[model samples]
Target: MTNVIFTVGNDMRADDGAGPFLAALLEADPAAGWEVIDGGASPENHTHRIRALSPKRVVIVDAADMGLAPGEVRRIDEDCVARHFLITTHAIPLNFLIDSLRETVPEIVFLGIQPREIVFMAPMTDDVRRGVAALHRTLVDGVGIDSFPGIAE
Candidate 1:
């Protein structure tokens, strides 16, 4: 089954850039089992491509204000998306986007990296960068998605 990965964030906003940074890294030398998309702030823009891919699973990576230490990575409970985190700055909300995508993708998962700072024109923090690097290695190394921390099987 095909697997798709969507990284969403605003590069202009400090740690929020983690998504695209990781996307670029994965894209440069993509792994065999996944298709990486630099979804940016408007992930909804890629709905067509996702539908076209007919993936069985979709993993979304984004920087969220999850009230955790900076660079901490965890699988956000789908039920808590709206309440506990600062989602994308796009017009469409992340929860709605995920619900809509569920029509095509059977399994949808979210990986959230806590942001140290989201100030405009700032660079990504070292903490978030390290987290991104670690995630990149796990995915590239073919670790099972079930192995992702904080995600309930």
Candidate 2:
């Protein structure tokens, strides 16, 4: 049994790159019981990957414009991800995909970083960078880690 974390985002949009950025970090420390997926720009299309892995608990990280101050952090559950997380991956929105995966992946969780700037292809803000660093530490410590049968698939 192992856990999987899916970092989803668009690299062009500054802080929106949180997911992929974290994925890069996690990929470095790939010991036993860890799986990192950088589902960049197109998470919905990666249904096969999710299904294939079938993690017990999946943590989806992203930057969302949640009307909060820059660098604010909010942990969203599966049901609420569509309402808060703002991603420019594809025509089909996150909410749509979340709803579709609800029955299939009832244990998915969301970790959102409130981004002050979503400017195209920009670098991440200092605040978001620090917050991501903090989150990276937490994940490394297994703050949200859990066991799943197919996570290693």
Candidate 3:
């Protein structure tokens, strides 16, 4: 089963760039069974490609306002996604996007990293960078979704 990853964010916005930055890293040295995409701020733009991949697992990494401390990461489950309207800069709402993708992908994982500063022309915060690195490590180690830190229960 192909593993697909979609990183969504706006580089111009500080910590919001986490998705793009991580995408670049994974693209450079992608996992053995993974296809990485930099979905940028509009993940909806890449839905066609995602559908074409016919992946068994789809992982989406994005900065979210989960009311946690800066740099914290959490796995937002489908139920939470349906219940809360997250603040995103995508053309289509995240809930709808994920729901549409769910029809094709067997499993979808939404990794939400708490962003400290999301401002124009600002660099990513140190804490968030560290968090991204940790996430990258976990992916490389092939850890299960249950192993990720701050995962929603």
- Tens-digit lDDT track for model 3 on 1-153? 688888888989999998898888777666667789888988888989999999999988888888887877788876675355255666777778888898899998898888998898999999999888777777767774557655444
Name the candidate, 2 or 3, with the larger TM-score value: 3
Give lDDT per model, in order.
0.84, 0.69, 0.81
Steric clashes per prediction: 0, 1, 0
Q: Which candidate is the best by lDDT?
A: 1
- Output the TM-score of candidate 3: 0.90
Q: How does model 2 fare in lDDT? A: 0.69
Which run of 10 residues does model 1 get worst, by summed lDDT? 144-153
lDDT of 1 at 130: 96
Q: What TM-score goes with each of the models?
A: 0.93, 0.81, 0.90
With a 3 Å backbone cut-off (N, CA, C), the pairs that clash in candidate 2 are: 12-121
Tens-digit per-residue lDDT, 67-139, candidate 1: 7789888887776765667555766888888899999899998888888988899999999999888888888
User: What would you estimate as the lDDT of candidate 3?
Assistant: 0.81
